[model samples]
Target chain A: MRPILISCHTRPVIAVKFNKDGDLFFTGSFDGKVSVFWSEPVERLGTFACDGAVKTMTVTEDSKYIVIGTAINGIFIFEVETGTKVKTIEFSSKIHVRDVEFAMGSQQFFMISYESDEKKQSVVYIYDFESVLNREQPSRRDLVRRDRDHYYRGVWGYLNKTIVLGTQNGIIDVVDTKTGELLLSHRAHVNQITSLAFSPDFSMLITASRDCFAKLLDPETLKEIRVFNAQRPLNSAVISPLMLNEGSPKYHCLVAGGQEARDVTTTATDQGGFEITFYNMIFEREIGSVRGHFGPVHSVAVHPRGHMFVTGSEDGTARVHILDQDYFTPAYD
Target chain B: MADADYIEREHIEATADGTYKITTHIKIQNKTVITNPDIERRKTLPKFGDCKNLSKGDIEGSINIEDKEVFLQKSSQVRAEENITKFNLNRAHKEKLDALTRRERAIMSGETEEQKTRRPIVTEREEFSVKVSNLPDNIDQDVLQNLFGTAGRVRKVFIPRGRDDNLPRDFAFVHFDTKAEAEKAIKQFKDYPLGHHILSVEMADRRNQRRNVPMSNRRGRK
Candidate 1:
């Protein structure tokens, strides 16, 4: 069969995340649909859509099942092959969710809920699926919900121990993934916190948002190490997970893409368009700009190994580009 | 414009290379208009062909889509004429109509009206148009001759086809030689009781008066 066009009336796909082996990728659309596209051989045209457009997808460190946080419809865990809808968690009390992720190397997962009940009364729920992974009888314990009005959007796990979450009101909460204990919560950005990603080493953390800047923060001290003013409001920034692989010796840069036009309606005419700027992850200064797409460049994914990676757009095309170090090349440094 | 409201197509002509002449005379009528190959279906129905023996337009200075009053007046005469089922093919058509109407839903599904050619009929006649909407999409001239041939002597059955899309129009217009025979067809098929599709029959417009629509709206009418 040919690829048929499918569109969700709500939102265009904003973020798509592939599982560890890249066999399945979860796509989250603005339409509140978080769908999984699984390719038996990781091939195109073999891609099939799951029921919803998921915003983000994270796999357990062992690459077993994926946990995706959705809008309105709640979170869904898919078994992938036979489309077995393994587990679903919903607070249904009109709690909207912005981001979802699982703990590093842990079978359990964490979800962030919105301030639905009260004007600012909010909570983040962590559902433990340790038994599901252990195969006790195909089920796990119910979720442990945390009420925190300060926590907002981004969440991640690092070093198989620390859980890092960024909130909508510009706060970053660092919690212990093992005990579900809150470790650190700091206002990282000046505006709404868009996303957070930890360097593969788990030592350095990155956050960006409508504040028009991307900052590298030390997860331990909760202090901004370096601040770089991006050309546009940064939506998302991701560092390569396999940075410095094979001991290439090049400075693995922290690259970010941001929206220039600033508005959605007149996105078509913006010539300089959206900018994908690169920076040395450690030194943190503007390196260069990558251009082409016409709308808000929303998300970035550094490919696992090679210098090639992709960035998604509101203009409807996700661009994959080749990036290598510059100024002080690997040979010079 | 009111006088020229309804028109039907008789035929189209072209030059040797299939190009048409500058100005062609068309036949037009409402009640009992006479038309043959020579005139156009229009306001000024020229005096020509089988139409030579009668006045050009109806005495009411009007044309009705269906002459129900006329059909009512001559209904008995038509029924008596239908009793003469000359050709066996027509008897077969009658049987088919019976079969189709019995299977109601089947006619509605998988059966589409040929967008191009409807059974030929005078326009604005609900009885004529609606009945044709019910018939089989692809009935040819022979089948029509058999089906409607009961009312009178079937001289010709014209199924107008679209020049482009080629979708068949569901109705077929049939002409008979005599007024009594034409009236007989109107009486028999006017209600279109068979096959869920009953056809409407009427005195054919003289060839010039055969108009499917207004000259401006009608294709091939420069």
Candidate 2:
């Protein structure tokens, strides 16, 4: 199936996420802009600008506010409807916010930041979402402080009680949000972890890494369930929501990545591995792949309803793909 | 003896041309006719295979007798066998699910046996090597290594030479330890000036050697 290409960003796109209703999706780019697009018709709705390059972003479950983390060591919250800047928190310039995520159905969100100072520490900060928007000084707490491992991405665990963090050294850590306690830690890959995603029901966690493997894990215990192998380093891995449906379940997951951007110029288009690869989640086998991005794909987000998915790439474009009717059929085997 | 008798009256006339004409009148009788009862009865009889009194069993066989005690008993037996197999299959499926870990069961609950048995597709790994062309005749492996060394770790460098001339060729292949390094070299050194000539750098395309062309034949041709 052909994809709807959205080329608005001037630099590499770092993150793409869908709102709770799945009708709209937002893409955050290194160009310091976030674009909102309608998922069905694949039209650009609006754009939000950040002072610094956007590294990661998340929309609230109500789709009312968006939290943007940028390279300038700042987190900005804006009203989704009016595009008004509701709150802005600036940290010391040494720390680069790597990931930001909103807790499901709660006035709480957390961000992971890396400090490139003498200590070389990674920090996970949990903040009260309501305080950030309504109060003059927002209340925040460091869940994991001065950690040695460089965390690349963080995803909220089930019920928003814990947060899962993937690090540059291939370690996965689950930290309790309330008590600031490390719940579980395990070495999950051989190389740096690039992204982490949860299944629609939060029953499984998929982690993609620079080691050319995306793994399925138990969110609570950090146990390995299955592994999907690829030829190139993976930047993002997401499980399709259709697998959780009670009727006509589709056992599929998508992983997108390629040769690093520095290497892309030397490799041919076919050999670059710049495609979103589909894997059978149940069987852990490669089913198919969609190729479009000239550069590596950095992020992918599947619609909540499982009808479509959006991918952001280093090519400075985002693609919205409405899955073919054949993807929903159980005929892969 | 006769129901009605035909009466004829004749009249003769002569014209001036002496031509005579005769006129005659005749009386006819009418009578009612009766049909043969045997022939009518034969016409109303049913044709072949059109009898109303025929039973379904008469046309086919006693296999249509579904309500018989023996037939019912055999069907019940077949159904019981089918139920037993289905029950066994369900039990086997439950056993398989129970054998899986909690996480695996959560991820692979709805997958069938055939789908689980399918293997993953395997892809070939790429080698990191760059081909450098348009080199000076006096260029050696050291100069090439030093030039590409800024990009990444150099694994190996090879320069082919003519057997008779025993001199280095104008082209060389450089292998890097990683794809990133090779890409960096290509980017930094493409069309790089070297000894009055610019070097052309690109990714090495390694095609499979021709199996039909034997090495001995190739050497002979050379």
Candidate 3:
């Protein structure tokens, strides 16, 4: 499918997400702004400007509040209906939060923060939404500081059951959020892991890294199921949300975005740009490629309906692409 | 006696011409801010008397240089050298010059709020930095620079990265040339919208320093 709608941001779009129903989508830019739009009507609903860069944001499952994490500003909780900020929780002045995710159907959320200390290690902190609404003095419940030896890169909280973190040296740690216990840790890649995503069923995990490869692994055992060498530094990888039925034919596709080979130079005039590559998960081969961004692509999010996906780039804009009709309608022999 | 008198006029004409040349050389030196090679050549001469012993071609050759291409080339060379010399000033000197020029211009033009805002935010390691968070992810360095542009010249915008992610970790360090400008930004940009997100701005704590803290010493809690 072609890009039917194009929206522009004044700065690099860092995060693009579709709401739970796929009816509303929000795009966040480094300029510290968030824009909400109605998906079907393609109309801008409201915009909230933060004090710092809008690094990560999530709408709680109940859709009552939109939680935003700014670069240094702090965590903001806004009422979804009135667009009024309800509460703000700040742990530090200069928090380098990597990711923020709300646990499924829960008020608790988890975030990974990178500290500038000597070892450059990172930690995972969990907070309760009720704390902010309650105007509590201390809202953060658990702070899991990683050891100095391992530097954390990316993080994701799954079903309120586990918080998974990817380290710089390529190890993935699965921890129990409630107990603050590391349930599992395994070396997942040769280099630093940049992003991690799970399939619709949550049975398979996909990881992309600086090592130039994205691998699919079983979430339970963390075993490598398939690997695709992108031959370039990858920033994000996402599995399509089409795999709903367990017995249905596996038509899910993997979408990845990052710098292309020979385009690593940071010069403005350099012929370096990023590409969004799509692959068939079952076949493990690239199916298509889309290129337009003038800089490295940083993040990608698939529409919950699996008909469209969005990608954010260092070039300061996000693009939404619709999947070709043929992919969804599989060819039956 | 007549021959001696003729020689005297020649000497006097040359001396007068030499004096004129010296004045012109000084003027050019001050205007261009370059040390001309011709000035150095004149320095080596024992006296103006030495110039008279030269042949007519020598006399015409030196004077005619003003109309020739060689002088143009020499002036261009001087211009390049002047540029290099100006570029080599120490940081403190450069900053002083910048501040002076800015102040002079501000006085002459009258201070607009925008002009009043332009100051250096990051002067040293931790002095003039403002911590900015909640920035929209789409905003890049240029947008960030423009967002803080009102406060002054942002020395640098440090967007901290995760260990591997290409996008910055959620927050950034905005360094100004001076603490005053940074503090001004904290006041002005509080809850400013950069794009879709409103920014959270504050004077960074001294403990909130640029990268390079020892890993073990990195205190993440509280």
**Candidate number with the higher TM-score (2 or 3):** 2
Task: Pick the lDDT winner.
Answer: 2
Clashing pairs in 2: none
Candidate 3 regions exceeding 4 Å error are A5-7, A117-121, A149-158, A245-250, A260-273, A331-333, B1-222
Instruction: Pick out the ten consecutive residues of candidate 2 chain A with the lowest summed lDDT.
Output: A37-46
TM-score, per-candidate, Cα-based = 0.50, 0.60, 0.56
Model 2 Cα shift for residue A36 (angstroms):
0.6
Give the C-alpha interface root-mean-square deviation per candidate: 38.8, 33.0, 35.7
lDDT of 2 by residue, A194-284 (tens): 9998998898999998877789998878888987766588999999988878878877888999999999999899889888887888776
Output the worst ten-in-a-row residue range by lDDT, candidate 2 chain B: B65-74
lDDT tens per residue, model 1, B73-113: 11235334444542343345335534544333444465445
Q: Is candidate 2 or candidate 3 better by lDDT?
A: 2
Best by TM-score: 2
Against the true structure, candidate 2 has what lDDT? 0.76
DockQ for candidate 3: 0.00
